[model samples]
Target: MSQEQRLEEQMLSQEAERRLSEQLDGAEKIDVDVQTDLLKIFQGQADGVSVTGQGLVMRGIRVQDIKLQTDSVAVNPLSAIFGQVELNHPINSTARIVLTETDINHALTSDFVRSKMQNFELNVEGEIVCLQPQEIQIHLLANGKIGFTGKVLLKEKGNARPVSFTAQVCPRTKHKPIMLENFNCTQGEGISLEVVVALMQKVKQLVNLPYFEFDDVVLRVKNMEVQKGTVTLLVDAHVRQIPASASNS
Candidate 1:
């Protein structure tokens, strides 16, 4: 390649790295390590990128020690080698994501629900039920309730009972508070275990937290599954690229 071509390739690579670094700025409790090379720029290919990371702490939910691994990811050579980088094309990749039950519990109790129920004594737990192609089932328990007189009520001794709900994780949306859908629970005679309005409000607020934003990218959960006490999410994200002039500025 001519010196002019080499210089342009270096500029493209540097621009890509800068954009990625800006996207990950201020990420909480998550550490991402990514390596990229432009050795094949002259060949019109980007096949020298690898990513691996561990201990990604989810903000609203108390999930810690999340791990992500991806092998060498190939990209459109012409786009990356040139000044215009279009990531719209799908790149076949092998990846693995892992999360533990303890992380789920932490996420549930960390910010939204747990903080909202500070007036009442609350104990929450989550259990992964199944892992399949694109579905996840989780059983959640809230062991106490707030009384009418503004007092917290604990579970009774002989008849200890708790409010429990079964939720399924599905595709996420920008307007949705969480991936949990079709929430259902059991009820006894003359008793109704309905979700209160306050709880719903808190949930909405939780989903609007700052941690959910990904710079100019829109990220949504495409699928999720549970396996061996862990839940893994397949996320789909779209990045809004900055204009060339703005980036240059």
Candidate 2:
């Protein structure tokens, strides 16, 4: 790589690192061994999710803005002889978002609940984000991570909410294919991209961000002590073409 390209790459890497640090610095950790109480899952995160129609509309619930980590990869053939190409390798791109307590903290709990001597844990019958077509699932895994598939919804049954998210948790790009974009904090030539939407489309949000990502996510919060809900995810993408001269100078 040329010195200038090296410098640019370094800057991008630096920004990525800085963003990761900031995220970790501000993160409120949830212990994997400790199961948390129940909390509400918002249904309105659909806003800004797409430039299409307003997301699902419900009676008593609204989709809260959700934090997400997304990833997208593109595979292209360097050269095609005839109708056949040799091989295509995968190029992975990622993105992320951090939501505050006020953002997606529909779940709530307090230190007082943890203080319960005998009753160490209580299953909080968290409120469901009642709505028309729940877009996602309220997933409570065994590792204490609160999560949902692309089909965001709230069907928590005190024990665990049944997410509305289906196998097609990931949404697809309506206008342009998400697989054709490359993204960086700084604007450049990569194809048209939206990290957040791509994540929701792939139904693979949070797959890119490992720090906040839960392996076998679970709920550890107590019912009455619930104060905040922890939702972690990452988003990433790769563009079809970068204006070579603009980005690669």
Most lDDT-accurate candidate: 1
Superposition TM-score, candidate 1 onto the true structure: 0.36
- 128 in model 1: Cα distance from truth in Å? 32
Write candidate 1's Cα lDDT for 1-249 as tens digits.
Answer: 567655765666566545544543233444333334456554444543333445543345433334433334444557665555454343433334555665664554454445444332222223111111111123322221111111122232224333333333332334443443433433223222222323333333533343333345455554445554565655543444432333544
Clashes by residue pair, model 1: 44-77, 61-107, 62-106, 62-107
Error of 2 at 194 (Å): 38
Listed in order, each prediction's TM-score against the native is 0.36, 0.19
In model 1, which regions exceed 4 Å deviation? 1-50, 58-96, 112-164, 167-184, 187-215, 241-249
Q: 25-94 in candidate 2: lDDT tens per residue?
A: 1323211110111110011010011111111112212223223221221212222111111113322233
